[model samples]
Target: MDRAPFHPGPPAEVTATPAGDRWTLRFVRDLRHPPERVWAALTDPARLREWAPFLADRDLSTPGDAVLTLVDGDAVVAQPATVRRAEPPRLLEYTWDEDLLRWELTRTADGTRLTLWHTVADRGLLPMVAAGWHLCVDVAERLLAGDPIGPIRGAEAIGFGWTELRDTYARRLGDA
Candidate 1:
């Protein structure tokens, strides 16, 4: 498999919707992989380590409770989360800290359409969160393509690509 050069771009489509005092950030991406494959990456801890910002202590394939450890450089913060919903190869949702993360997958003509909806309590952190998810999805694509890259997270992620992507998303989200 041939891998394309890394492109630091915002998501294909991202929307911020205000609901009450919180905001929901939705990221849409069409991945060139099957839903089953994508689902594995989303729930499998070993695969997540290749792309996600956190590692799970247990399999998230079923609806239940699990611990997620947020990884940043050499730092780790463990948080308990309940799998609010789980439908294999289609949907998975859970709570992250004070927020909720929902992943929806659909089979597309060429591959799969992955949509991530994250609810955040602090609207001020929208830019940072959006940028981090952008990088995460990008890494996920690479990992699924058989050309994985090292994780860029924690202070490294917030200070690195997060800076530029945050500015771009901030502008797009009208938060600038």
Candidate 2:
């Protein structure tokens, strides 16, 4: 049976390495679309909401500084995310809590090369975090190609991402 084209396997040449508790996911896809088109998909709030599940409501057209709100069921996670690195059709970075989230886009011979890096909470929530980020990247790629892929349900929906939140605190030395 043929699979839906909305989701594509990570580009054959992709790499992920452990960085302390954080992980770095770097891959390059030859998206058929132009960088400007891809950039807007990454920066526009309406487009973002369409692709990313956590974002219920937010605006990005007036891109400068804003308080971003992300929802996971009844709980709401708000972070003061800023466009730290903006190069237009190139790089975008912001603060997702303490960890830094960045997206690096390059206009390649084939298409746009995107590098998404997130220094989010790991150890306990690592697996779910990885899955969520992985899904986000998939959605971005699909959206650009005008595929019918849907927004991803965050780690919370599966009941595993939050299960390990307490483990992070237990690791503190002499904290018992």
Clash totals in order:
0, 0
Q: Write the per-residue lDDT of candidate 1 for residues 1-176, one digit (tens) a residue.
A: 32345666545587889867899888788999999999999999889888888999988988888999999878899999888899999999999778899999999999999999889987767777889988888888888988887666778775446788888888878882
Error of 1 at 103 (Å): 0.6
Candidate 2 positional error at 48, Å: 0.3
lDDT tens readout by residue for model 2, 79-169? 7766677778788777655766677778888778777765655544444444555556566677777763665555433442322322322
- Stretches off by above 4 angstroms in model 1 are 1-5, 158-160
lDDT for 169 (candidate 1): 83
* Model 2, position 11: C-alpha lDDT score: 26
Q: What is the lDDT of residue 42 in candidate 1?
A: 96
TM-score of 1: 0.92
As a whole number from 0 to 100, the lDDT of residue 108 in candidate 1 is 97
